[model samples]
Target: MKSLMPYLKARTVEELWEYHTKLMQSYGFDRLIYAYTCFQSAQSLTNPEDALILTNYPSEYIEAYIGHGLFRDAPMMKWASRNVGAISWRYMWDDPDNTPLGATRRELMALNKRFGITCGYTISFPMAIKRSAAGIGLVARAGMTQNDVDALWEDKGEELEIINQVAHLAITQLPATGQSRILTPRQSEVLELVADGKSVRDIALLLGRKVATVDKHLRGARESLGVETTAQAVRKASVLNQIFIVDPGTQLS
Candidate 1:
Protein backbone atom coordinates (compact mmCIF):
# COMPACT_ATOMS: atom_id res chain seq x y z
CA MET A 1 0.00 0.00 0.00
CA LYS A 2 1.17 3.51 -0.84
CA SER A 3 1.74 6.00 1.95
CA LEU A 4 -0.99 8.56 2.56
CA MET A 5 1.79 11.22 2.37
CA PRO A 6 1.63 11.24 -1.46
CA TYR A 7 -2.09 11.99 -1.39
CA LEU A 8 -1.60 14.60 1.33
CA LYS A 9 0.80 16.48 -0.96
CA ALA A 10 -1.33 16.26 -4.12
CA ARG A 11 -1.15 19.55 -5.99
CA THR A 12 -4.32 19.42 -8.09
CA VAL A 13 -7.73 17.76 -8.05
CA GLU A 14 -7.14 16.01 -11.36
CA GLU A 15 -3.78 14.66 -10.23
CA LEU A 16 -5.30 13.39 -7.01
CA TRP A 17 -8.23 11.70 -8.76
CA GLU A 18 -5.96 10.01 -11.28
CA TYR A 19 -3.63 8.63 -8.63
CA HIS A 20 -6.50 7.46 -6.47
CA THR A 21 -8.16 5.71 -9.43
CA LYS A 22 -5.00 3.76 -10.16
CA LEU A 23 -4.57 2.84 -6.52
CA MET A 24 -8.16 1.57 -6.20
CA GLN A 25 -7.82 -0.47 -9.39
CA SER A 26 -4.85 -2.24 -7.87
CA TYR A 27 -7.25 -3.49 -5.18
CA GLY A 28 -9.75 -4.98 -7.68
CA PHE A 29 -12.14 -2.03 -7.65
CA ASP A 30 -11.61 -0.43 -11.06
CA ARG A 31 -14.11 2.27 -11.95
CA LEU A 32 -14.88 5.06 -9.52
CA ILE A 33 -16.67 8.38 -9.08
CA TYR A 34 -15.82 10.99 -6.45
CA ALA A 35 -17.96 13.92 -5.34
CA TYR A 36 -17.56 16.72 -2.80
CA THR A 37 -19.85 19.60 -2.08
CA CYS A 38 -20.18 22.47 0.35
CA PHE A 39 -23.72 23.12 -0.88
CA GLN A 40 -25.49 19.95 0.11
CA SER A 41 -29.01 20.09 1.50
CA ALA A 42 -31.86 17.84 2.53
CA GLN A 43 -33.04 17.70 -1.07
CA SER A 44 -29.84 17.50 -3.12
CA LEU A 45 -26.39 18.88 -3.65
CA THR A 46 -27.68 22.33 -4.55
CA ASN A 47 -25.97 23.66 -7.67
CA PRO A 48 -24.06 20.79 -9.21
CA GLU A 49 -21.64 23.37 -10.56
CA ASP A 50 -20.49 24.06 -7.01
CA ALA A 51 -19.47 20.44 -6.43
CA LEU A 52 -16.19 18.72 -7.16
CA ILE A 53 -16.95 15.53 -9.15
CA LEU A 54 -14.37 13.27 -10.75
CA THR A 55 -14.88 9.93 -12.41
CA ASN A 56 -13.43 7.16 -14.58
CA TYR A 57 -16.76 5.75 -15.66
CA PRO A 58 -17.57 5.48 -19.35
CA SER A 59 -18.23 8.84 -20.93
CA GLU A 60 -21.64 7.72 -22.08
CA TYR A 61 -22.53 6.59 -18.59
CA ILE A 62 -21.38 9.89 -17.13
CA GLU A 63 -23.30 11.82 -19.72
CA ALA A 64 -26.45 9.88 -19.05
CA TYR A 65 -26.04 9.88 -15.26
CA ILE A 66 -24.96 13.45 -14.55
CA GLY A 67 -26.42 15.09 -17.62
CA HIS A 68 -29.81 13.73 -16.63
CA GLY A 69 -29.28 14.45 -12.89
CA LEU A 70 -29.66 10.78 -12.01
CA PHE A 71 -26.82 10.69 -9.47
CA ARG A 72 -29.02 12.25 -6.82
CA ASP A 73 -31.01 9.04 -6.67
CA ALA A 74 -28.12 6.63 -7.03
CA PRO A 75 -28.30 3.90 -4.39
CA MET A 76 -24.82 4.41 -3.06
CA MET A 77 -25.27 8.16 -3.11
CA LYS A 78 -28.46 7.86 -1.08
CA TRP A 79 -26.62 5.60 1.35
CA ALA A 80 -23.67 7.99 1.52
CA SER A 81 -25.88 11.00 2.13
CA ARG A 82 -27.16 9.78 5.49
CA ASN A 83 -24.22 7.69 6.61
CA VAL A 84 -20.44 7.73 6.85
CA GLY A 85 -17.73 5.10 6.47
CA ALA A 86 -17.33 2.25 3.98
CA ILE A 87 -20.26 0.13 2.80
CA SER A 88 -20.66 -2.61 0.27
CA TRP A 89 -22.96 -2.40 -2.73
CA ARG A 90 -24.72 -5.47 -1.42
CA TYR A 91 -26.14 -3.36 1.35
CA MET A 92 -28.80 -2.22 -1.08
CA TRP A 93 -30.21 -5.65 -1.91
CA ASP A 94 -28.82 -8.24 0.44
CA ASP A 95 -30.57 -7.01 3.58
CA PRO A 96 -33.70 -5.35 2.32
CA ASP A 97 -35.48 -5.71 5.67
CA ASN A 98 -33.42 -2.84 7.10
CA THR A 99 -33.66 -0.45 4.16
CA PRO A 100 -35.59 -1.59 1.17
CA LEU A 101 -34.47 -0.59 -2.30
CA GLY A 102 -37.03 1.62 -3.97
CA ALA A 103 -38.23 1.40 -7.56
CA THR A 104 -35.89 4.22 -8.57
CA ARG A 105 -32.90 2.44 -7.05
CA ARG A 106 -33.83 -0.82 -8.72
CA GLU A 107 -33.88 0.94 -12.08
CA LEU A 108 -30.66 2.72 -11.28
CA MET A 109 -29.12 -0.61 -10.48
CA ALA A 110 -30.18 -1.90 -13.87
CA LEU A 111 -28.57 1.08 -15.53
CA ASN A 112 -25.37 0.51 -13.60
CA LYS A 113 -25.32 -3.13 -14.57
CA ARG A 114 -25.47 -2.11 -18.20
CA PHE A 115 -22.13 -0.39 -17.61
CA GLY A 116 -20.60 -3.34 -15.78
CA ILE A 117 -20.97 -1.62 -12.42
CA THR A 118 -22.54 -4.35 -10.36
CA CYS A 119 -20.64 -4.70 -7.10
CA GLY A 120 -18.42 -2.30 -5.17
CA TYR A 121 -18.13 -0.02 -2.18
CA THR A 122 -18.88 3.56 -1.29
CA ILE A 123 -16.87 5.48 1.30
CA SER A 124 -18.45 8.67 2.54
CA PHE A 125 -15.89 11.00 4.07
CA PRO A 126 -16.55 12.71 7.37
CA MET A 127 -17.15 16.41 6.81
CA ALA A 128 -16.51 19.27 9.23
CA ILE A 129 -18.30 22.12 7.47
CA LYS A 130 -21.97 22.80 7.81
CA ARG A 131 -24.02 21.40 4.92
CA SER A 132 -20.92 19.84 3.39
CA ALA A 133 -20.34 16.24 2.29
CA ALA A 134 -17.90 14.13 0.28
CA GLY A 135 -17.90 10.53 -0.90
CA ILE A 136 -16.57 8.13 -3.51
CA GLY A 137 -18.19 5.12 -5.25
CA LEU A 138 -15.82 2.39 -6.35
CA VAL A 139 -17.20 -0.21 -8.79
CA ALA A 140 -15.74 -3.65 -8.83
CA ARG A 141 -14.18 -4.79 -12.07
CA ALA A 142 -16.15 -6.93 -14.49
CA GLY A 143 -16.77 -10.50 -13.34
CA MET A 144 -16.32 -9.58 -9.67
CA THR A 145 -19.08 -9.85 -7.09
CA GLN A 146 -19.96 -8.11 -3.85
CA ASN A 147 -18.81 -11.23 -2.05
CA ASP A 148 -15.41 -10.78 -3.68
CA VAL A 149 -15.38 -7.12 -2.59
CA ASP A 150 -16.31 -8.11 0.95
CA ALA A 151 -13.51 -10.62 1.03
CA LEU A 152 -11.01 -7.97 0.04
CA TRP A 153 -12.50 -5.51 2.50
CA GLU A 154 -12.27 -7.92 5.37
CA ASP A 155 -8.51 -7.92 4.96
CA LYS A 156 -7.55 -4.50 3.57
CA GLY A 157 -10.50 -2.18 4.28
CA GLU A 158 -8.70 -0.08 6.86
CA GLU A 159 -5.89 0.91 4.50
CA LEU A 160 -8.25 1.59 1.60
CA GLU A 161 -10.49 3.73 3.78
CA ILE A 162 -7.53 5.79 4.98
CA ILE A 163 -6.25 6.33 1.45
CA ASN A 164 -9.65 7.52 0.22
CA GLN A 165 -10.23 9.85 3.18
CA VAL A 166 -6.79 11.39 2.70
CA ALA A 167 -7.43 11.89 -0.99
CA HIS A 168 -10.73 13.62 -0.21
CA LEU A 169 -8.92 15.96 2.19
CA ALA A 170 -6.34 16.77 -0.47
CA ILE A 171 -9.13 17.53 -2.94
CA THR A 172 -10.59 20.14 -0.60
CA GLN A 173 -7.21 21.90 -0.47
CA LEU A 174 -6.97 22.18 -4.30
CA PRO A 175 -8.94 24.17 -6.82
CA ALA A 176 -11.86 22.23 -8.30
CA THR A 177 -11.18 23.44 -11.82
CA GLY A 178 -13.23 20.48 -13.09
CA GLN A 179 -16.01 22.29 -14.89
CA SER A 180 -16.37 24.40 -18.04
CA ARG A 181 -16.29 27.62 -16.01
CA ILE A 182 -12.57 27.93 -15.31
CA LEU A 183 -11.85 31.56 -14.41
CA THR A 184 -9.53 33.50 -16.65
CA PRO A 185 -6.81 35.65 -15.12
CA ARG A 186 -8.93 38.74 -15.61
CA GLN A 187 -11.97 37.21 -13.94
CA SER A 188 -9.89 35.95 -11.06
CA GLU A 189 -8.28 39.39 -10.70
CA VAL A 190 -11.63 41.13 -10.60
CA LEU A 191 -12.94 38.76 -7.93
CA GLU A 192 -9.75 39.17 -5.92
CA LEU A 193 -10.18 42.95 -6.04
CA VAL A 194 -13.81 42.60 -5.03
CA ALA A 195 -12.84 40.44 -2.08
CA ASP A 196 -10.48 43.18 -1.03
CA GLY A 197 -13.47 45.56 -0.81
CA LYS A 198 -12.62 47.42 -3.98
CA SER A 199 -15.52 49.14 -5.71
CA VAL A 200 -15.86 48.96 -9.47
CA ARG A 201 -14.57 52.53 -9.84
CA ASP A 202 -11.71 51.78 -7.46
CA ILE A 203 -10.79 48.66 -9.39
CA ALA A 204 -10.91 50.62 -12.65
CA LEU A 205 -8.40 53.12 -11.28
CA LEU A 206 -6.19 50.36 -9.85
CA LEU A 207 -6.19 48.33 -13.03
CA GLY A 208 -6.06 51.38 -15.35
CA ARG A 209 -9.43 50.43 -16.86
CA LYS A 210 -12.70 52.29 -17.28
CA VAL A 211 -15.54 51.87 -14.76
CA ALA A 212 -17.71 50.18 -17.40
CA THR A 213 -14.87 47.77 -18.19
CA VAL A 214 -14.57 46.83 -14.52
CA ASP A 215 -18.31 46.20 -14.37
CA LYS A 216 -18.02 44.04 -17.46
CA HIS A 217 -15.29 42.03 -15.74
CA LEU A 218 -17.48 41.60 -12.68
CA ARG A 219 -20.39 40.45 -14.84
CA GLY A 220 -18.12 38.01 -16.60
CA ALA A 221 -16.94 36.62 -13.27
CA ARG A 222 -20.50 36.15 -12.04
CA GLU A 223 -21.35 34.28 -15.22
CA SER A 224 -18.23 32.17 -14.98
CA LEU A 225 -18.98 31.21 -11.40
CA GLY A 226 -22.71 30.68 -12.07
CA VAL A 227 -23.54 33.20 -9.39
CA GLU A 228 -26.11 35.99 -9.51
CA THR A 229 -24.03 38.67 -7.78
CA THR A 230 -20.44 39.83 -7.41
CA ALA A 231 -20.45 38.91 -3.71
CA GLN A 232 -21.57 35.38 -4.48
CA ALA A 233 -18.97 35.14 -7.20
CA VAL A 234 -16.23 36.23 -4.86
CA ARG A 235 -17.29 33.75 -2.17
CA LYS A 236 -17.54 30.86 -4.61
CA ALA A 237 -14.23 31.77 -6.26
CA SER A 238 -12.53 31.91 -2.90
CA VAL A 239 -13.92 28.47 -1.98
CA LEU A 240 -12.66 27.05 -5.26
CA ASN A 241 -9.29 28.79 -5.01
CA GLN A 242 -9.94 30.81 -8.17
CA ILE A 243 -8.72 34.00 -6.49
CA PHE A 244 -5.93 34.93 -4.13
CA ILE A 245 -4.08 31.88 -5.28
CA VAL A 246 -0.69 30.84 -3.97
CA ASP A 247 1.10 31.70 -7.25
CA PRO A 248 -0.26 35.10 -8.20
CA GLY A 249 3.02 35.82 -10.01
CA THR A 250 2.29 33.15 -12.62
CA GLN A 251 -1.30 34.18 -13.43
CA LEU A 252 -0.67 36.01 -16.70
CA SER A 253 -3.68 37.23 -18.62
Candidate 2:
Protein backbone atom coordinates (compact mmCIF):
# COMPACT_ATOMS: atom_id res chain seq x y z
CA MET A 1 0.00 0.00 0.00
CA LYS A 2 1.49 3.29 -1.08
CA SER A 3 1.35 6.13 1.43
CA LEU A 4 -1.03 8.79 0.08
CA MET A 5 -0.14 11.33 2.77
CA PRO A 6 2.13 13.35 0.50
CA TYR A 7 -0.52 13.39 -2.20
CA LEU A 8 -3.15 14.30 0.32
CA LYS A 9 -1.03 17.28 1.27
CA ALA A 10 -0.55 18.32 -2.35
CA ARG A 11 -0.84 22.06 -2.90
CA THR A 12 -2.77 21.72 -6.16
CA VAL A 13 -5.77 19.66 -7.19
CA GLU A 14 -4.11 18.54 -10.41
CA GLU A 15 -1.12 17.18 -8.52
CA LEU A 16 -3.36 15.26 -6.15
CA TRP A 17 -5.40 13.77 -8.99
CA GLU A 18 -2.32 12.75 -10.93
CA TYR A 19 -0.74 10.95 -8.00
CA HIS A 20 -3.99 9.24 -7.00
CA THR A 21 -4.53 7.97 -10.52
CA LYS A 22 -1.03 6.61 -10.67
CA LEU A 23 -1.54 4.83 -7.36
CA MET A 24 -4.73 3.17 -8.62
CA GLN A 25 -3.00 2.10 -11.82
CA SER A 26 -0.19 0.54 -9.79
CA TYR A 27 -2.86 -1.69 -8.22
CA GLY A 28 -4.06 -2.88 -11.64
CA PHE A 29 -7.09 -0.59 -11.69
CA ASP A 30 -6.36 1.56 -14.70
CA ARG A 31 -9.58 3.47 -15.02
CA LEU A 32 -11.28 5.46 -12.31
CA ILE A 33 -14.29 7.70 -11.84
CA TYR A 34 -14.44 9.73 -8.66
CA ALA A 35 -17.49 11.80 -7.78
CA TYR A 36 -18.54 13.79 -4.76
CA THR A 37 -21.68 15.72 -3.98
CA CYS A 38 -22.55 18.07 -1.18
CA PHE A 39 -26.20 18.07 -2.17
CA GLN A 40 -27.70 14.70 -3.04
CA SER A 41 -31.43 14.61 -3.49
CA ALA A 42 -33.94 12.74 -5.58
CA GLN A 43 -34.85 15.84 -7.55
CA SER A 44 -31.32 17.28 -7.91
CA LEU A 45 -29.48 14.17 -8.99
CA THR A 46 -28.81 15.77 -12.34
CA ASN A 47 -27.85 19.15 -10.98
CA PRO A 48 -24.48 19.78 -12.61
CA GLU A 49 -22.84 22.00 -10.00
CA ASP A 50 -24.03 20.01 -7.00
CA ALA A 51 -21.77 17.13 -7.97
CA LEU A 52 -18.11 17.07 -8.96
CA ILE A 53 -17.06 14.25 -11.28
CA LEU A 54 -13.55 13.29 -12.37
CA THR A 55 -12.83 10.36 -14.66
CA ASN A 56 -10.20 8.79 -16.85
CA TYR A 57 -12.67 6.88 -18.99
CA PRO A 58 -12.77 7.49 -22.69
CA SER A 59 -14.56 10.62 -23.83
CA GLU A 60 -16.97 8.73 -26.06
CA TYR A 61 -18.04 6.43 -23.27
CA ILE A 62 -18.47 9.37 -20.92
CA GLU A 63 -20.53 11.23 -23.52
CA ALA A 64 -22.81 8.26 -24.00
CA TYR A 65 -23.20 7.74 -20.26
CA ILE A 66 -24.23 11.34 -19.66
CA GLY A 67 -26.06 11.72 -22.99
CA HIS A 68 -28.26 8.71 -22.31
CA GLY A 69 -28.82 9.55 -18.63
CA LEU A 70 -27.19 6.25 -17.71
CA PHE A 71 -25.77 7.57 -14.45
CA ARG A 72 -29.28 7.57 -13.03
CA ASP A 73 -29.37 3.81 -13.54
CA ALA A 74 -25.73 2.91 -13.16
CA PRO A 75 -25.66 -0.07 -10.81
CA MET A 76 -22.46 0.89 -9.05
CA MET A 77 -23.74 4.43 -8.55
CA LYS A 78 -26.90 3.09 -6.94
CA TRP A 79 -24.85 0.84 -4.70
CA ALA A 80 -22.56 3.68 -3.65
CA SER A 81 -25.42 6.07 -2.90
CA ARG A 82 -26.81 3.94 -0.10
CA ASN A 83 -23.85 2.10 1.28
CA VAL A 84 -20.40 2.75 2.68
CA GLY A 85 -17.20 0.72 2.22
CA ALA A 86 -16.01 -1.18 -0.81
CA ILE A 87 -18.14 -3.74 -2.64
CA SER A 88 -17.36 -5.60 -5.78
CA TRP A 89 -19.82 -5.65 -8.65
CA ARG A 90 -19.95 -9.41 -8.17
CA TYR A 91 -21.34 -8.83 -4.73
CA MET A 92 -24.04 -6.59 -6.12
CA TRP A 93 -25.06 -9.29 -8.62
CA ASP A 94 -24.74 -12.11 -6.14
CA ASP A 95 -26.47 -10.35 -3.27
CA PRO A 96 -29.27 -8.59 -5.01
CA ASP A 97 -31.32 -8.06 -1.88
CA ASN A 98 -28.72 -5.84 -0.31
CA THR A 99 -27.58 -4.08 -3.50
CA PRO A 100 -30.33 -4.66 -5.95
CA LEU A 101 -30.11 -3.54 -9.54
CA GLY A 102 -33.27 -3.63 -11.59
CA ALA A 103 -33.49 -4.94 -15.14
CA THR A 104 -32.65 -1.59 -16.70
CA ARG A 105 -29.68 -1.24 -14.37
CA ARG A 106 -28.47 -4.68 -15.35
CA GLU A 107 -28.68 -3.64 -18.99
CA LEU A 108 -26.67 -0.56 -18.20
CA MET A 109 -24.08 -2.76 -16.56
CA ALA A 110 -23.88 -4.91 -19.65
CA LEU A 111 -23.58 -1.84 -21.81
CA ASN A 112 -20.52 -0.87 -19.78
CA LYS A 113 -19.07 -4.28 -20.52
CA ARG A 114 -18.85 -3.43 -24.21
CA PHE A 115 -16.54 -0.60 -23.21
CA GLY A 116 -14.25 -2.88 -21.15
CA ILE A 117 -15.60 -1.53 -17.90
CA THR A 118 -16.69 -4.95 -16.82
CA CYS A 119 -15.03 -5.92 -13.56
CA GLY A 120 -14.18 -3.61 -10.68
CA TYR A 121 -14.85 -2.60 -7.12
CA THR A 122 -17.01 0.34 -6.11
CA ILE A 123 -15.85 2.14 -2.98
CA SER A 124 -18.35 4.39 -1.19
CA PHE A 125 -16.85 6.43 1.60
CA PRO A 126 -18.71 7.23 4.78
CA MET A 127 -20.27 10.69 4.55
CA ALA A 128 -19.15 13.01 7.29
CA ILE A 129 -22.01 15.43 6.76
CA LYS A 130 -25.64 15.14 5.90
CA ARG A 131 -26.62 15.43 2.25
CA SER A 132 -23.02 14.71 1.26
CA ALA A 133 -21.47 11.61 -0.36
CA ALA A 134 -18.34 10.55 -2.19
CA GLY A 135 -17.30 7.41 -4.06
CA ILE A 136 -14.87 5.94 -6.55
CA GLY A 137 -15.39 3.30 -9.21
CA LEU A 138 -12.21 1.43 -9.98
CA VAL A 139 -12.36 -0.30 -13.36
CA ALA A 140 -10.07 -3.22 -13.99
CA ARG A 141 -7.89 -3.31 -17.05
CA ALA A 142 -9.13 -5.09 -20.16
CA GLY A 143 -9.46 -8.90 -20.01
CA MET A 144 -9.65 -9.00 -16.21
CA THR A 145 -12.51 -11.09 -14.88
CA GLN A 146 -14.50 -10.70 -11.72
CA ASN A 147 -12.56 -13.45 -9.99
CA ASP A 148 -9.23 -11.89 -10.87
CA VAL A 149 -10.30 -8.46 -9.66
CA ASP A 150 -11.83 -9.86 -6.55
CA ALA A 151 -8.58 -11.63 -5.75
CA LEU A 152 -6.69 -8.37 -6.06
CA TRP A 153 -9.15 -6.62 -3.81
CA GLU A 154 -8.97 -9.40 -1.28
CA ASP A 155 -5.26 -8.78 -1.11
CA LYS A 156 -5.41 -4.98 -0.99
CA GLY A 157 -8.93 -3.79 -0.31
CA GLU A 158 -8.25 -2.42 3.17
CA GLU A 159 -5.35 -0.31 1.97
CA LEU A 160 -7.37 0.88 -1.03
CA GLU A 161 -10.13 2.12 1.25
CA ILE A 162 -7.68 4.17 3.32
CA ILE A 163 -6.08 5.60 0.22
CA ASN A 164 -9.44 6.57 -1.25
CA GLN A 165 -10.66 8.18 1.94
CA VAL A 166 -7.64 10.45 2.04
CA ALA A 167 -7.96 11.12 -1.66
CA HIS A 168 -11.57 12.19 -1.25
CA LEU A 169 -10.67 14.56 1.55
CA ALA A 170 -7.91 16.07 -0.56
CA ILE A 171 -10.22 16.47 -3.55
CA THR A 172 -12.88 18.26 -1.53
CA GLN A 173 -10.35 20.86 -0.41
CA LEU A 174 -9.50 21.84 -3.97
CA PRO A 175 -11.13 24.79 -5.67
CA ALA A 176 -13.91 23.66 -7.99
CA THR A 177 -12.51 25.58 -10.90
CA GLY A 178 -14.86 25.70 -13.88
CA GLN A 179 -17.13 23.14 -12.24
CA SER A 180 -19.61 25.89 -11.30
CA ARG A 181 -20.46 29.40 -12.30
CA ILE A 182 -17.95 32.03 -11.34
CA LEU A 183 -19.30 34.70 -9.03
CA THR A 184 -18.01 38.24 -9.26
CA PRO A 185 -15.79 39.67 -6.49
CA ARG A 186 -18.72 41.65 -5.13
CA GLN A 187 -21.02 38.63 -5.23
CA SER A 188 -18.45 36.53 -3.41
CA GLU A 189 -17.90 39.23 -0.78
CA VAL A 190 -21.62 39.55 -0.15
CA LEU A 191 -22.09 35.79 0.11
CA GLU A 192 -19.17 35.45 2.50
CA LEU A 193 -20.60 38.08 4.84
CA VAL A 194 -24.01 36.43 4.57
CA ALA A 195 -22.47 33.09 5.54
CA ASP A 196 -21.00 34.81 8.57
CA GLY A 197 -24.62 35.60 9.54
CA LYS A 198 -24.53 39.26 8.66
CA SER A 199 -27.73 40.99 7.74
CA VAL A 200 -27.98 43.10 4.59
CA ARG A 201 -27.77 46.25 6.66
CA ASP A 202 -24.72 44.95 8.49
CA ILE A 203 -23.07 43.99 5.23
CA ALA A 204 -23.80 47.43 3.86
CA LEU A 205 -22.27 49.05 6.94
CA LEU A 206 -19.26 46.76 6.82
CA LEU A 207 -18.57 47.45 3.19
CA GLY A 208 -19.51 51.15 3.46
CA ARG A 209 -22.27 50.70 0.89
CA LYS A 210 -25.94 51.64 0.97
CA VAL A 211 -28.53 49.08 2.03
CA ALA A 212 -30.02 49.06 -1.49
CA THR A 213 -26.66 48.35 -3.03
CA VAL A 214 -26.03 45.46 -0.61
CA ASP A 215 -29.48 44.02 -1.30
CA LYS A 216 -28.86 44.24 -5.02
CA HIS A 217 -25.60 42.36 -4.71
CA LEU A 218 -27.24 39.62 -2.68
CA ARG A 219 -30.08 39.32 -5.16
CA GLY A 220 -27.65 39.19 -8.02
CA ALA A 221 -25.72 36.41 -6.28
CA ARG A 222 -28.89 34.40 -5.72
CA GLU A 223 -29.89 34.81 -9.33
CA SER A 224 -26.42 33.99 -10.61
CA LEU A 225 -26.39 30.79 -8.57
CA GLY A 226 -29.92 29.87 -9.65
CA VAL A 227 -30.93 29.62 -6.04
CA GLU A 228 -33.92 31.18 -4.30
CA THR A 229 -32.53 32.21 -0.92
CA THR A 230 -29.40 33.86 0.41
CA ALA A 231 -28.63 30.77 2.47
CA GLN A 232 -28.83 28.58 -0.57
CA ALA A 233 -26.66 31.01 -2.48
CA VAL A 234 -24.06 30.93 0.28
CA ARG A 235 -24.02 27.13 0.41
CA LYS A 236 -23.86 26.76 -3.36
CA ALA A 237 -21.13 29.33 -3.54
CA SER A 238 -19.14 27.53 -0.85
CA VAL A 239 -19.59 24.18 -2.55
CA LEU A 240 -18.36 25.78 -5.75
CA ASN A 241 -15.36 27.14 -3.80
CA GLN A 242 -16.45 30.59 -4.81
CA ILE A 243 -16.55 32.21 -1.35
CA PHE A 244 -14.59 32.74 1.84
CA ILE A 245 -11.34 32.96 -0.06
CA VAL A 246 -8.87 35.45 1.35
CA ASP A 247 -7.18 37.96 -0.86
CA PRO A 248 -4.33 40.19 0.25
CA GLY A 249 -5.54 43.07 2.44
CA THR A 250 -9.18 42.10 1.84
CA GLN A 251 -11.19 42.44 5.03
CA LEU A 252 -14.60 41.02 5.93
CA SER A 253 -16.28 41.70 9.24
List ranges where model 1 is wrong by over 4 Å: 93-103, 177-181, 248-253
**What would the per-residue lDDT of candidate 1 be over residues 1-253, giving only the tens digit for each residue?**
7767767666677777888888899999889998887777777655568777889998998877888777766767777777889898887555323667677667677788799888889999988887778899988898888899999999999999988888877777777746423788888898898899988989999999999998988898888878898988887787677877665235467
Q: What is the lDDT of residue 112 in candidate 2?
A: 89
| Candidate 1: count of backbone clashes, pairs at least 3 residues apart or interchain | 0
Please write out the lDDT profile of model 2 over residues 155-204, one tens digit for every residue: 89888888888988877776663443367889999899988889999999
Q: Tell me each candidate's RMSD, in Å, in order.
A: 3.5, 3.6
What is the Å distance of residue 142 in model 1 from its true position? 1.8
RMSD of 2: 3.6
TM-score of 1: 0.86
- Candidate 1 lDDT (Cα, 0 to 1): 0.80
